[model samples]
Target: MGLRTRPIGFGYFKTKFNDKVLQDEQDVGTCELLQDSKVRIIISQEPEKSNLLRLEEAPLIKRIELLFHMEHSSIPMSLEVDVSDTIGKLKERIQSIESIPVNRLVLSFLGNELNNRSTIHECGLHHQTHIEVSIRASPPAAASTASGSNAGSKKLKLLVLPRCGTKKIPVEVNASDNVGELRKQLPILQEKLRFSLPSNGYFFIHKQSVMDDKRSFRWHHVNQGDTIEIFNGWVTRGS
Candidate 1:
């Protein structure tokens, strides 16, 4: 990392040249010659200097694709967002597009909830990386309705991705069933995917958090086209 010439704005004058590299302190006299070369020389394996040099070459991720997985909205809008934008900034962008308050929404990628302090790259997202966007909970009355009768329930289609596998299972679940009930259907899923199910290592996830066993489908506001993801772990990552 230190071999790369880093363009430190207005910082060229601050670094002290290695006198041993030049052979004499008096011989290292031309600042103009150094600026034209644009190289930061580090002869010593000093941990602190190497760390600083690594920071100087930090990767730059400009854009990422976000897949909004909302209960009421199933439209797969492929959004390209700036990686420099922090998670908070990304929320604000979504808020402007969806008109939902940023505080009421959560974003997750690869089964991890993004924090306000993290940038997209810091959150392990890369170019064309897909993320899940959902409401933190059931929206206000304007957005939600009465729970109504359970008889109206329909099949809830979900995509379950195993941690150790690349294929995604199209899981069919009853809208009236709580997320925990999905476990009963695991045998069928295992048969379809031909993959061994985790004995005690998995749970249903939404909004980057584990679903409550007692929460009904009504409480979670699940609807058609909404996903019930199964991440590989006893608990959600970075939950």
Candidate 2:
């Protein structure tokens, strides 16, 4: 019996012959790939780091604590409000808690009457700033009645921006009207409009706060030409 030598295939011979060259190429390729991957990781992280830096550099919101003094009272009342709050808004806060009529309340800082449209910061109010509170004297009964009636009868053009619609609905309403009364008119308003309004229960938002159904537009600080956002759901508090 003739014993044949074990045959070495051409593939095995080539691999063994070029082992060092293949290994060198693979090592260089791996180093280059690793360097590319590291560069990509660093580039991706730069944007995130910049975003964090920008956030850190952003200015903090300042809140001002104001001292209110009533002419009749010796004690000083304190209220904290954002620097961005309007004088009208501060008056509203005082009205809600102190039971003062917003229309009659007068706010004065440094002997200057603060306008309703002026912001707290614009009025040169700082933390612990003292403000004088006074009530306007009541006019004659008949004249007061006539003025009140005229004011109540005046129509306000409210720009209603529904959450689901693009077209703003401008409605003529009385400032004395409540939110519930306005809700009732939505269906009637839908009839006149080309676009459909939200059919389900909805609520109104004013000054970034939800408006109560029992409160009038004046109560919510909703003025003429103010935009009221209609949201299609009920907001549950304390949940």
- Which of the numbered candidates is closest to the native, going by highest lDDT? 2
The TM-score of candidate 1 is 0.33
lDDT of 2 by residue, 93-198 (tens): 9999789889889999879889999999888899899999999876588477767767775568888887654888888888888878877877788778865566
lDDT of each: 0.65, 0.74
Point out where model 2 deviates above 4 Å: 1-58, 141-239
The RMSD of every model to the true structure, in order and in angstroms, is: 20.3, 26.7
Residue-level error in angstroms, candidate 1, position 221: 32
Clashing pairs in 2: none
lDDT of 1 by residue, 116-195 (tens): 87987778777666678878766556334444454546567877666544566777777677767777777877886696
Per model, state how many residue pairs clash.
0, 0
Instruction: Give the least accurate 10-residue stretch of model 1, judged by summed lDDT.
Output: 19-28
